[model samples]
Target: MQYDSISHFLRTGQEHLAKGPVALIFAEDDVEINTTLRHHLDLGFSKVVLFSPAAFNIAPELAEKCPRVTLESPRGEPMFDAVNAINDAAIGVWLYYCFNSEYLLYPFCESRTVGEMLTFHTEERRDAMLTYVIDLYATDLETNPNAVSLDSALMDRTGYYALARNDPDNHNHPKERQLNFYGGLRWRFEEHIPADKRKIDRISIFRAKEGLKLRPDFTFSDEEYNTYASPWHNNLTAAVCSFRTAKALKFNPGSTFQIQQFKWHNSVGFDWHSRQLLDLGLMEPGQWF
Candidate 1:
């Protein structure tokens, strides 16, 4: 159920690598580890691989179902490297990666499983799926100092936008069908977040292949995997409802005292449904009617 290290898992945990649609959850802290694990498990993933530190407390039942890899420090480059390593090992498998406290939301997810969605996506010839990381936070930071409360979660309904993704190698021409999406907590708190980390667009659901590398910027070595859709029409896009930003701002000494609250006039309670996200234009179902 657990491995001593990433290498140890790769060497002996080949059974887990045999399947498709595995979720790789990297826990930076102990926050919401059980719920996050349970969420993906409920999504019908073939395997849920958790990379967490030894000190983090995990629910006994969840610990039995999910494979936990002992990762003392899961952040920055190391996290990306681990993803790349696993990706290389599980060639052709559909892989989804996210941090703890993040939940994946696809259209009609209440009834349809993630595997079903991927099946439809694959039929359309898409090797990857674009997802927006919608920032979620507790409305009252005074009571929830960490700015994370699932019950009190709020998200900006009107802050999302996207710009052309320019290709430097192609003389700065915009990449076809690719856009650098922005907004959520990153856009609102730009001072605290680095410019490079401000984009919300991520190819979160992708098929792993030989030599596939997940970059530190949350992209892949294969440029096509970074596209938002196929050249002809719009494709399905998912949303990752996350409290990672809110938690980070409160955790960091620099921004902790500055942000007393995360709510505004435009802030609305997250309904935790794909319909609400679709109505807000956060994600699209495309041709998946």
Candidate 2:
């Protein structure tokens, strides 16, 4: 089903909004649209919705399967407004959002479904799941000028770090369980990237509630939802192996010429499995074992 606008989707697409664990995909471009939808559908989302401009060429079969919302401008503020509206309409549902060329990876995701992970998380009283946006790019930018080749996708195995999240309202003291995570392509090419867009941490998986708003920084209106874990112990964390950064850096004229190749001594082939991310300390199983 296709909706002409976000408001149209909210008004008449309530059936799709009825279920929990819905995957909200915002397509910045046509890059890997089909594969992105396929990955999340296979991950077991109850409903998968695509927000893309009409110009995008979506596969006929996928077009028939997923609800597509016609979004003239799908980035920045418009994207956030759409999400907030959907959150209001779909209260109590588990929601996850990402762009094209991004795939979600949780501990034991290979064997277990995303629904199973969320069930376990809900049992732990978690309202949101923190995800690291690990940058993926092709080793040879010459062959794939866009820096997006899933077959040759490489990611930084190291360089990830976290710092205390300070609260402005609380006299600069660190937040209880929240931290500002950084690294990946953003950290390495900080000069080209804007300061606000550099953080790799995103609370991508969350529960929708009344008055819940997704902030510009990719955090949330609720402080607890921004936390990495519960007060008692560490909870499950996930990683989103993405080519978004790679695509941006390579497409932007300012940085495109400067970056000859994304590969480096620390670069490693992404195995597309949970175990590799776990081994690299990119994500944690917490107490899910």
Which candidate wins on lDDT? 2
Give every collision pair in model 2.
none
Residue 168 miss distance in model 2 (angstroms): 0.9
Q: Which stretches of candidate 1 lie above 4 Å from their native place?
A: none
Per-candidate TM-scores read 0.98, 0.99
lDDT at position 153, candidate 2: 92
Model 2: lDDT of residue 232? 95
| Residue pairs of candidate 1 with colliding backbone atoms | none
> Residue-wise lDDT of candidate 1 within 186-277, one digit each (tens)?
99999999999999988889999898888877878889899888888999999999999999999999999898889999999999999999
Q: Which run of 10 residues does model 2 get worst, by summed lDDT?
A: 11-20
User: How displaced is residue 226 in candidate 1, in Å?
Assistant: 0.7
Q: Model 2: residues >4 Å from true position, as ranges?
A: none
